[model samples]
Target: MTAEKANNLLEQIARSKKEGRLPPVHDWHPPFCGDIDMVIKADGSWHYMGSPIGRERMVRLFSTVLRRDDDDYFLVTPVEKVGITVEDVPFVVTAVQVRDVEGAQVLEFTTSVGDTVVASAENPMRVELDPQTQEPRPYILIRDRLEARIHRNVFYELVEMAKPTLIDGVEWFGVESAGEFFRIAPVS
Candidate 1:
């Protein structure tokens, strides 16, 4: 990313943070400023100008303005929008907490960017098997089309908490959170 573009993005982010809430990215419709060299790697590390962004606070600040439109991701402000690359999902679920809510299981996930979300109808979990590797790639909806890739250790903990059930004609092993049962994998 050019120095000018990077400064522009940071200024917008700062202004949005001062408002004490996320910018209305969904409502912003700025013309695309073309793709920037910024990328969020598969492990949820942000890179700019081919160098790792070492500051946690800056990464968190940028994440607040992230928006996904269809298949593309952008850092959106009310007046400008710049596209960025995401290797996998833009966030990673670094930790998980399971609690009893009204006698039902409720799983809360903390993302690498420090955002917390609960697994419920509004923020559902899904697993898709890789076509080539056949490995399960699990994700949970974080916000407005953005998802957090469930870390491997957290996924394993979820597997340990799973129960077997029959959905339609297929038997599956899954876990329940907030009274919703999400299929994690087919019975093996």
Candidate 2:
């Protein structure tokens, strides 16, 4: 990315962060400024011009303005929008916090970019098996079509908390969070 372009993007994100809220990029209809040499890799690392973004604060700031439209990702502000590449998803679930509220289990996920979201109907978790490896790839919805891939250790924690239950005549292993049962795998 060019210095001028990076500076413009950083300036806008800094302003939005200072307001303590994200700007409504979904509501804004700005002209696309074409693609930039930026990519959010599958492991949640931010790269610009083929180099990893070393600053945590800088990555966090850029994440706030990220938006997904259809299959494309963009860094959007009110006045400008620039497309970027994402390998898998934009975020990664770094940690999981399990809590009990009135005997109901609640799973809270902390994203790499520092956003926390409770697993519920609004923010649901799903697991998809990898086609080649057949291993489960779990993800949790964050916000506005963005999802976080659950870390391996966190997924192990979830598996430990899972219970066997029957769903629609099929035995399943899953966990309940926020009164919703999310099936992790079907018992054989």
Best by TM-score: 2
Error of 2 at 120 (Å): 0.5
Residues 39-109 of candidate 2 have per-residue lDDT tens digits of 99999999998999999999998999999999999999877899999999999999999899999889999
TM-scores, all models, native as reference: 0.95, 0.97
Tens digit of lDDT per residue, candidate 1, span 70-180? 899999987788899999999999999999988888999999999999999999999999999999999999999999999999999999999999999999999999989
Every candidate's lDDT: 0.92, 0.92
Model 1 Cα shift for residue 4 (angstroms): 3.1
Once fitted onto the true fold, the runs of candidate 1 whose alpha carbons sit more than 4 angstroms away are: none
How far is each candidate from the true structure, as Cα RMSD in Å?
A: 1.2, 0.9
For candidate 1, report its TM-score: 0.95
- Each model's total of backbone clashes: 0, 0
